[model samples]
Target: MNRFVRWLSASALALLATIVLLPQPAAAAPIPCGHDCLGISRDAICWEKEWCAVPIEIKGTLPKEGYALPYRTADGTASAPADYTEVREGVLWLKPGGSLQLEVFVEGDSVRERGETFLIEYLDREGRVVATATVVIRDGV
Candidate 1:
């Protein structure tokens, strides 16, 4: 009787341990944009004298939170405030399932020169690149 009781108690403990050690499945979070969640109307733009506007649209499930879209001009013959007016580095209050616009200015000049090209990028909070748009400034001589 004593041996049977001990065996029963050990079996119960082993069963309890097995149950406690079992791994639980984690709750999965939904992906806001599965693959292509962000989009831009024009990847490249041509501007002369007048400012150019590029439209950006977000497509997919709207996130519950709003994001501040970060952007910067880089690696282009055009210089900020020289070739054109300084573009706003970042935009604010960009909510999910919404759209925004980026404006590029071209400073008027008389000298004939090759068109200048520049890139405008959108970055996440972690500074990761989300999207990019190229602007071509054709000299209006």
Candidate 2:
């Protein structure tokens, strides 16, 4: 499985993806508001952006293991289950006067370090309003 994950992480758009670790305030400051947090690596941070062909990636680092990744529409419509290790990636595309939304959830079994989630949104080329993405998190390590 590790091999497969490595392959997927490199061969697919995931290579063009950007996953970041999100730890809850119980451990540090709240994200989405410019929190000074660090990932196991430097690629674990996303300042936030909206609407475009750009890939929207949310990463969850479970201390012990288990995790999930679901991608849904801004209004919670059109969804696809894609929870995995290594990394997860979601592509967003919107037209003028449209938007996209998503929520990323992460849960693990480790003291002071379980997981993190993020609400990601993207804007169209013309910078118009659109939809959002839906993300769901669960517990299980």
Best by TM-score: 1
Cα RMSD (angstroms) for every candidate in the order listed: 18.1, 19.5
Q: What lDDT score belongs to each candidate, Candidate 1 first?
A: 0.65, 0.29
Query: Could you give candidate 2's per-residue lDDT for residues 28-88 as a string of tens digits?
Result: 2111111222111011222112111223332332223222222222322212222212113
List where candidate 1 sits over 4 angstroms from the true fold: 1-37, 61-66, 92-99
lDDT, candidate 1, 99-126, per-residue tens: 5566766677778888888777666667
